[model samples]
Target: MTDRIEKIVRDRVGEEPVCLFAYDLDRLAEHVRAVVDSLPARCRMFYAMKANSADPLLRALAPLVAGFEVASGGELDKARAVDAEAPVIFGGPAKTLAEIERALRRDVTRLHAESALELHRISEAATRLGRTVEVLLRVNLAGPFPSATLAMAGRPTQFGISEQDLPAAVAAARSLPGLRLTGFHLHSLSNNLSAEAHLELLAHYGRTVAGWEREFGLRCEVVNVGGGIGVNYADLDAQFDWASFSRGLPAVLDEFPAGVREVDFECGRYLVAACGVYAAEVLDVKRNHGVDYALVRGGTHQFRLPSSWQHSHPFTVLEVDEWTAPVPRPELREASVTVVGELCTPKDVLAREVPVERLRVGDVLVFHHAGAYGWEISHHDFLSHPHPEHVFHADAS
Candidate 1:
C-alpha cells in the first residue's frame, strides 16, 4: 500500500467512519497490458465480466481485451455501454430463451452452446431472426486436471456436455439449421497454479478438437481454452507464470490440426483480483476463552471470499493513532488475533489466528486481492449493514 492510497482511503472515510474498497485502476491497466502484450499472434483475450464488472474495471479493460464474455443479459448490456462495438461471446450452463433471443438480436461473436437443448434454442432463435448463428460446443472433458484448486470438468456437473456424448451432440448441432459449429469451449479448472499443467491441458484440447473434426468433419476455426489462471493467495510470492506460458503457447498452437485457426481465452479473476483491497475498521479487540479475537464493523455479508472458501484471508494491519473512546485501548503485542465480523455466526471470521505486530480497536484490516469476487458476490442486505465506500485510485503504486 502506498501513502497516496492510504490518503485516498482517509479521504473516502471522511467524517463518518466505515469500511472502504480501494481499487487501483493503474495497477489493473498495467497487469492487463502485460498479459495482452505477451500473447501469441493467433491467440485472443476476452475479459470474463463475471469476475468484476464494476464500471471502472470494464472501462479500463475495454480497450485492451478483444471483447467481453457475458453470462447474463444485464452484463451484455453493461459490456456494450462501455465498448459500443466490442464482440461478445455468450455462455452459461442455464440460459433463458429470452436471454438467448437477446444475444442473437445483438452482434454476438458466438453463443457457447452448453447443452443439446440450448443448441436447439440458439438454432430456433437464429432461425426466427433469419440469421445464421456461430457457436462453440462447450464440452465437459472427463478427466482430472494436473493441478487446480477447483475442477469444473472431469465429472458430471451442470457445466457442459460430456465428452462421451460429443459425437452425437456435434452431429445434432451440424444438422440444425442456422447454426455453425465454429469451435469448442473447454473451461476445465479454477485457480490452476501450474503453467506446465495448463500447457498440457491446452495441448489436450488441441488434440481432442482435431480428433473431433476428423471424425465429425466439422470446420473448427477457434479453440476456446477457457481461463483459470490462478492467483496464489496462500503464497503471495508465487504467481502464475504468464511469460513462460506465453512463450510455450506458439509451439502448442503448431500442434493443432489443419482446420484450427484461432485460440480464445476467457480470463476473469487473474485479470482484476490483484488491484483491489477491502478495508474494514476494527470495532473491538478482546481475548475470549484464552484465544485472541478482533471484531470488525463488517461481516461475511460485505466480504464473503474468506467465509465462502473457508480460508484465512490474508490481510495487513493499517495502524491507527487516533482513538477517541473514553476507555483505554486494548493493546496487544505479537498476538494471533482471529478477526471476526459483526455477523452473529462462527462463519463470519475473515483471517483466523493471523499474527500481527500491534492491532488496536481503531486499526484497519486491508484484505488483499479482493478486486474480483469480494463485494460483487457478497450478500449486502444481511443485517442491513451500510455499504462500503468504493474509492478508485488512478495512480497508486
Candidate 2:
C-alpha cells in the first residue's frame, strides 16, 4: 500500500469496519501515457470500458487512449457521456436492435459484428436509420492457443463467428446494404501474459486476414485485436512484458497485408489494474479445523477477481496499533492465514493460506493490482452488504 492509501485507511478506520477501493489517478495517467507513446505506427490503443468504467478513470483515459471500446449500450452511453466526440467502437456477442439503433445514432466509429446474423441486424438497423455504418466481423479462429488465465475463443464459446463461417460472414457483409466491411476482429484469448506469444498470435491474424483477402477479394483495413493482456496477481513483481511487446510490435505489424491500415487494441485490465488497491479491515482472527482464517469486513462481493480467477491474490498486512474495544484483540503472528470476507457463502474467500508476519484485528489488508475488474466485476448487492467506498487519489501538487 502507498503512504497515501495508508493515511486514508488510518483516517477512515474507526469503530466501524473499513473497506474501500483507492485509485491513484496520477499513476494511471503516467502509465497510460507510456503505453500509448510506446505503440508503433499503425497501432492504436482503445480503452475497454467494461474493465473499469469509473468516471475518473474514464476521464483520465479519454485523452490518453485512441478511443473507447464499449461492449454494451450502457458502456457506449458511459463512453459518450465522458467524451461525445471521441472515437468509439461497439463490440458484444448479443447486441439488441435497440443497441444497434443506439450505436448508429451515437455515430460509433466501428461495429464489430459477431456473426452473419449480426451483420444482417447491423445492415437492417443502418438501412432503417438511413446511415452507412462501418463494420468488422469478429472471428473465432480454430486454434491451439497458448496457456492463459482464460480463453474466449479456440473453442465452442458464445463469443464470435466460427472460423468455418467467416467466408459466409464476409459474403453477407458484402451483400448487406448501408454497411461497409472495413476489417476483421480476431480476439481469441483473455488474460494472455506472454508478449512473444501475443506477437505470434498477431502474426497468425495477419496471415489469416491476408488469406481471406485473397480468397474473398476483400480489402481489410482495421484489425481489432481485443485486449487480453494480463496482470500477475500471484506475483506482483512479475508482469506482462509490455516493453518487449511494444518494441516487438513494429516487426509483427509489418508482416500484415499491405492493404491493412490500422491495428486496434482494446485493452482493459493491463491499462489500469496497477493503479488501484482494495483495503479491508480484519474483523476477526480464528482457527477452524486446524486452519487459520482472517475474516475481513469485505469479501468477494466487493472484489471478485480472486475468487473468479481462483488465484491466491497478493496482499500486504498494514499494521495499525489501535484498539478501542474493551475485549481482548485477536492476533495471528508468523503463520499462514486464509483471508475471508463477510459473505454467507463459503466461497467468499479472497486469499487462502497466505503467509503473513503479524496480523491483528484492526490492521488493514491491502490487496494490490485491483484497479480494473475489481469492483466493476463484483456482485455488490449480494447479501445486502454495504458497498465499499471509492476513494480517488490525485498526486499532491
Candidate 3:
C-alpha cells in the first residue's frame, strides 16, 4: 500500500462512516492500451461501457481506446459526452426502434443486428433517413462457453441470432437496400478465466467468418470476438496470458478474403477490475452459533457480487491509531469472521469465512478488485442506503 491509500484509509476511519469506491484510471488506461497495442494491425478495441459507466473513468479511457460498444441509448449518450469523436458500436438483444434511430442519427460505426426483425427495422429506419446502415450480424455459435453454463448455457438466452439462420439472414440483408452486412458478431460466454475457451471461441468464429466471406463473395470487415476477459481478484500479481490470446487471432484472420479487415474486441472487466476498491467501515461484530460475523453499514445493497455470485473480495482492515514505526501491531490479533452488510435478508454477505486482523466497530475495511461490475451491474434501491460514493485518482502518475 502507498502513503496516499494509507492516509485515505486513516481519514475514513476517523470520520463519519461512508463507503468510498476508489478508482485508479491511469492503471486501467495502461491495461487497455497494452491489450490494444498487442493486437494485429487491423484490430480495433472498444471499451464496453456497461462495465463501469462512471464519467471520470470513461473520460480517462476515451483517449486511450479506439471505440465504445454501447448496449443502450443511455450508454451511447455517456460515450458521446466524453469521447464524441470515438467510434461507437451499438449492440444488444432487444433494442427499441427509437434507440436504433438514435444510433443511426449519431452515425455509429456499426449496429450489431441481433434478429431478422431488428435487421428489417434498421433497414426501414435507414431508408427513412436516406442513408445506408452498416451492420454486423450477431451469430449464436453453439459451443461450451462458461457464460453458457452460468446464465446462457442451458437457459433461453436472447443474445444473438442462431447459427442456423445465418444463411437466410445474410440473403435477407443483401436485399435490404439501406442495410449493408459488413461482418459477423459472436459473443460467447465470458467471466470464465480460461484462455483456452476464448481461443476455441475465436477459432470457431474465425472459421465462420471465413465461410461467410466465401459464400457471400463479400469480405467480412469486422470480426467481433466479444468481451469476457476475467480479472485477477484473488491475486493481483497473478499473470494473465495476453500472448496466448494474441496467438490465436492470426489464424482466424487468415480465413478472411479481404485479408482480415479488422478484428474488434469489446473488453470490459479485464480493463477496469483491478483499479477499484470499495471502502466500508465496520458497524458491529457478533458471534452467532460459534461463528463470528462482522456487520458493516454497506451490504448487498451497495456491492451485490458476494450474495449474487458467491464471490469473495480481498479485504484489509485499516487501523486509525498512530504508530511511530512501520511495524505490525503486536496488540492486534487475527480472527476468522464473516463480513456482512446491514440488509433485511439473510443473504446480505460481503465476505464469507474471511480472516482479518481483529476487526472492531468503526474500523475501515477496503475491498480490492472492485473496479468492474461493482456498482454498474446490480444496484437495488432496496434499503434506502445511499449508493457508494465514487472517488477517482487523477494522478496515478
Candidate 4:
C-alpha cells in the first residue's frame, strides 16, 4: 500500500470498521500514459470500460486512450457520460436492439458485431437512424490457442462468431445496407501472461486476416486484436513484459498486409489493475478447527476477483494500534491465516493460508492489484452490506 492510502486508513477515528477502495489517479494516469507512449505507429489503445468504469478512472484515461470499448448499453452510457466526444466502440456477444439503436444514435466509432444476426440487427438499426455504421466481425477462431488463465475462443464459449461461420458473417456484413465492414475482432484468450505469446498471436491474426482479405477481396482498415494482457496477481514483481512487447510490435506490423491500416487494442485489466487497493478493517481474528481466519468488515460483495478467480489475493496487514475496546482484543501472530469477509457464506474468502507476521483487530487488510474487475464485477447488494467508500487520491502539484 502507498503512504497516501496508509494515511487515509490511519487518520480515521470512527469506531466503525473502515472498508474502502482507494485509487491513485496520478499513478493510473502515469501508467496509462507510459503504455500509450510505448505503442508503435498505427497502433491505437482503446480503454475497455468493462474492467473499471469509475468516473475518475475514465476521465483519467479519456485523453490517453484512442477511445472507449463498451460491452453493453450501460457501459456505452458511462463512456459517453465521461467524455461526450471521445470515440466509442460497442462490443458484446448479446447486444439488444435498444443498444444497437442507442449506439447508432450516439455516433459510436464502430460496432463489433459478434454474429451474422447481430450484423443484420446493426444494419436495421443504423438504417432506421439514417446513419451509416462501421463494424468489425468478432471471430472465435478454431484455434488450439496459447494457454491462458481463461479461454474465450478455443472452446465452446458464447463469446464470438465461430470460425466456420465467418463466411456467412462476412456475407451479411457486405450485403447488409447502412453498414461498412472495417475489419475483424480476434480476441481469443483472457489473462494472457506472455508478451512473446501475444506478439505471436498478433502475427497469426495478421496472417489469417491477410488470407481472408485475399480470399474475399476485401480491404480492412482497422484490425482490432482484442486485449487479453494479463496482470501478475501471484507475483506483482513479475509482470507482462510490455517493454519487450512494444519493441516487437513493429515486426508484427511489418508482417501485416499493406491494406490493414491500424491495429486497435482494447485493454482493460493491464491498464488500471495496479493503481488501486481494497482496504478493509479486520473485525475479528480466530482459529476454527485448527485453521486461522481473519474476518474483515467487507468481503466478496465489494471485491470479487479473488473469490471468482479462486486465488489467494496478495495483501498486507496494516496494524492499527488504536484498540479502545473494553474487552480483550483478538489478535493473530506468526501464522498462516485465511482472510474472510463479513458475508454469511462460507465462500466469502479473499486470501487463504496467507502467512502474516502480526494481525490484530482494527488492522486493515490492504488488497493490491484491485483496480480492474474489483468493484466493477462484484455483487454489491448481497446481504445488504453498505458499499465501500470510493477514495481517490492524486498528488498535488
Instruction: Go through the candidates in order and give each one's C-alpha lDDT.
Output: 0.86, 0.91, 0.77, 0.91
- Across 1-397, the per-residue lDDT of candidate 2 in tens digits comes to 6688778777888878889999888889999999999998889999999999998889989999999999999999999999999999999999999999999999999999998889889999999999999999999889888878888889889999998888888889999899999999988998888999998988888888899999999889999988988888877888999999999998888778888889999999999999999999999999999999999999999999999999888998888897889999999989899999999888999999988989999999999999988899999999998999999988763
TM-score of 4: 0.98
Query: Please, what are the lDDT tens digits per residue for candidate 1 over residues 153-174?
Result: 9977899999888988898788
- Report the C-alpha lDDT of model 4 over 1-397, residue by residue, as the tens digit: 7788778767763677889998888888998999999998899999999999999889888999999999999999999999888999999999999999998888899999998888889999989888999999999998888888998897899988998988888888998999999999999998989999999999999999998998888998989999999998999999999999999999998778888878999999999999999999988899999999999999999999999999999998887777778999988889999999999999999999998889988888899999999999999999999999998888862
User: What are the clash counts of all predictions, listed in order?
Assistant: 0, 0, 1, 0
RMSD of 1: 1.6
lDDT sort, best first = 2, 4, 1, 3
TM-score, every prediction: 0.97, 0.98, 0.91, 0.98
Off by over 4 Å in 2: none
Q: Which one wins by TM-score: 2 or 3?
A: 2
lDDT of 3 by residue, 1-397 (tens): 3345546556555445757788776677777788887888887888898888999999888887888999999999998898767899999889999999999888799899999999999998899999898899887776655542243322357878777777889988889879988888777766756666667667767777777787878777677878867765566667457778787767656655566678788988778877788888777788889778888878878777666677677788876454344444333247788888878888888887787767766677888888877788656588788777777775643
Candidate 2: residue 310 lDDT (0-100): 92
Which portions of model 1 miss their true places by more than 4 Å?
12-15, 395-397
Clashing pairs in 4: none
After superposition, the stretches of candidate 3 with alpha carbons farther than 4 Å from their true spots are 1-3, 146-155, 255-258, 322-333
C-alpha lDDT of residue 294 in model 4? 95
